[model samples]
Target: MEMNELKAITEGLLFASGDEGITVKQLARVLDVQGHTVEHLLEELKYDYDNTGRGMLLMQSHEVFHLTTKPEHSPYLKKLLETPQSTKMSQAALETLAIIAYQQPITRTEIEDIRGVKSDRPVQTLIARSLIEEVGRKEGAGRPILFATTKDFLTYFGLTSLEELPPLPDDINTDDLEEEADLFFDTFSEQIDQSNHR
Candidate 1:
């Protein structure tokens, strides 16, 4: 097919998919062309989007492609993603969720050790929210339940997979340990302080 025709059809397919854009391999399979051809076409399309004053552009990550509105369009996009009443969790819950996501299959006791406090309430809240779940029981003396992140966690965070999580520094230092401890306290301390204040 002609280049213009290819671009048009590809854009049409992307639009038809809405938030889900056709990957290069999928497009190649559908068009009976090589994957490189589809990739070249996508590159050309991306250039067009960059040159033209279109309201949106294409993005690829975690083996998926998507057409998203330009960041400049956030004010309008907010009208769609925003809700009347937003759901929120305590900071303790957020910390527990992060730890579970990073160190999955870890037991409540391990989490407590990291946080240096009981994590029952936060773990319960995360489980209730479907962000974390009991993966299985640990093989130990007590056989405590192990927790891990759920698919809902990825969807909620707009991540296709947990592998997309940002990389952490490999170095270990006193500052790093102090920061982790501070984070643990900061997460739970505010709520405790607020209740104490009252």
Candidate 2:
């Protein structure tokens, strides 16, 4: 395929990969080209994005490439996020989010065990919002899928990292878990509101 065609295909793959991004090796394998060739194409693409006055940028992190909006466009992105339609989160979803945040890499069964109710819908909602994702699978009989918070979650909460999360109270009673979830949601929402105003 032509270089231009390969570049276009690489762009699509990068967009589809989301936060996971794509490695040069992965791109080369998919495009049936040498690794160095893929690296050259990526450099060309990155240069084009930098010079074209495009709203988006091609970013490299940990040798993985992904498409993301330029930092200068953050104010507009914040505006979009502040819209009521986009900010809404149901109570069930909030509860699930709190549970996932506190006990990430947790399985659905574990979440249900804590809540004492079915959590399929809430889990789906979190995934749809891009706040949580399938981080891995548990090592057990069924190898149930494990969920974890995403970078989007940190941004939404105005947290720089997971280490910034408030520590959970020790020696807490099991009955207070639901209330704790509510507290977590309130804290996160407060931070998000503060971030939106800035």
Q: Candidate 2 overall Cα lDDT vs. reference?
A: 0.79
C-alpha lDDT values of all predictions: 0.70, 0.79
Residue pairs in steric clash, candidate 1? Answer: none
Per-residue lDDT for 100 in model 1? 78
Off-target runs (Cα >4 Å) in candidate 2 are 89-99, 102-198
lDDT for each residue of candidate 2 in 49-167, tens digit (9 for 90 to 100):
99989888999765668898899987887787567786677667777788899888898877877666678768866776689999877775544678999999998876899998977
Model 1 agreement with the true structure over 109-184: per-residue lDDT tens digits: 7776776777777886677567897787777553466889999988776679988875444653434543664554
Question: Any runs in candidate 1 off by more than 4 Å, and if so which?
Answer: 1-86, 173-178, 181-198
Q: Could you tell me the TM-score of candidate 2? A: 0.53
Scored by TM-score, the top model is 2
**Most lDDT-accurate candidate:** 2
